[model samples]
Target: MLIYLLKRLLMTILVIAVTSVIAFLLVHLSGDPAAAMAGEGASPADIASVRETFGFDRPIVFQYLEWVGRILSGELGRSYYLRMDVSDILADHLPVTATLGVMALSFALLLSIPLGVAAALRPNTVIDRVALWLAVAGQALPSFLFALGLMYLFGVYLRVLPISGGTTWAHFIMPSVALGYYATPAIMRLTRSGMMDVLQSDHVRTARAYGLSSWRVVIRHGLRHAIVPVVSLAAVQLGFMLGGSIIIESIFSLKGIGYLAWESIQRADIEVIQAILLVIATAYAVLTLLADLLNAALDPRIRIS
Candidate 1:
């Protein structure tokens, strides 16, 4: 198990390294940081001054290496566009997105698990059909459009929830619902399938033959093995939530990392953009490794493999 964990950690580090390199190069090459920082209708001298101030005139490789070294040493550097510390900016906004993600994930699991279990328990029944329709609709609808409809129904007309600005718990409801429902389809389908397969396994039959009650066999024995794949898929879905939060955050005006990314893109803030990309990429790598570790812990076969 230790060996497997170490290997996974190494792979995660390598992936993050490659991602950082690509993000650095892409951000630098995408647009003129100097011009963006200088604002519209800036003179050539103003642009040159801005470039000089931000070290834009330096070789790209040198700048990238320097930035990487600083990042490794726990420095996010100052934002050229915002004229503030990049780390400070992220610190202020990261929690909002992080909280939203956690809430959304929780909502998804709460809804999907029961629906999936029900569908698996009574396949081809009304409950199963309802679950199938939900899964299909959740996947087919765009999150933003879904969010707008929710906002109108719940926020505008019903006045039960806030339409935007994730300040209070009420404000968080719609965004979390919109984001969480987007992930629900995949989870529900996978869970139902996993449960069905687990139930048909020899172990399940043996447990049933041993006089174990149906509920006990299904809950204690069946769900244990069935949840393994669900766990892995959930981790990936979480990464998607983090990445997809950009649109949701914008619609809701939440001061989260996703909203920060949107702002940085509009202004072409290279420093902020690069830092955000690196942060998100590292999160993806770490979460995937965590999923692998969790799977190995739950099922020893994974570690051996």
Candidate 2:
């Protein structure tokens, strides 16, 4: 297990390095950063000065090495537009995103698990059909559109929730619902499939033959076995939620990393954009690693590798 964990950690490091390099290069590939900063009206000397100051005049490799070194030493650089430390900006906004994600994920699990289990218990029935339709719709709709419709129904017409912004629990309603609903389809499908498979397994039949109560057989045998896959699915979905929050956050005007990313992109703030990409990528990597570790813990066969 220790060796397995060490190997995963090493792999995580390599993945992060690759992600950082890709993100950095992709941002540069679009055009000259200095030219973008200068906009359409800047003189030749202005562009040259901006280039020299930002080290655009240096070799790409040198710039990459220097940026990596600074990042390693806890310097994320200043936001080109805000003129503030990137770290400080992220620090202020991280909690809001994290909190919103937690709320959304919790709601998704709460909604999906029960619906999935019910669907599995009565396959091909009305409940199962309903669950299937929900899963399909949830997967099909874009989160931002869902957010807008929710805001209209629940916030504008009903006046039960806020239309935009995430200030309190009330403010979290629309955004969280949109995020949770988007995530539910994948989780529900996984849970339903896992549970259905477990229900048909020989072990379940053996438990039933032993005259165990149906609920007892399900709770003890079916749920435990089915949960392993569900947990893994949930983890991957949670990681996706972090990235998908950008659209939802933008619609709601929430002050999260997603909102920050949107703002940075509009202004072409390279430092903020780079830092946000690195942060989001690192988050996804860490969450995926955590999921892998959890999967290993849940399945002994996995830990052996």
How would you encode candidate 2's per-residue C-alpha lDDT over 66-110 as one tens digit per residue? 999999999999987788999999998888888788889999999
Every model's TM-score: 0.94, 0.94
Model 2 segments beyond 4 Å from truth? none
All models: lDDT? 0.89, 0.87
lDDT tens digits, residues 3-70, model 1?
A: 88788999999999999999998988888889988999999999999999889999998998999999
Task: Judge candidate 1 against the unseen true structure and give its global Cα lDDT, from 0 to 1.
Answer: 0.89
Rate residue 135 of model 2 by lDDT.
96
Q: Return the lDDT, model 2, position 167.
A: 77
Clashing pairs in 1: none
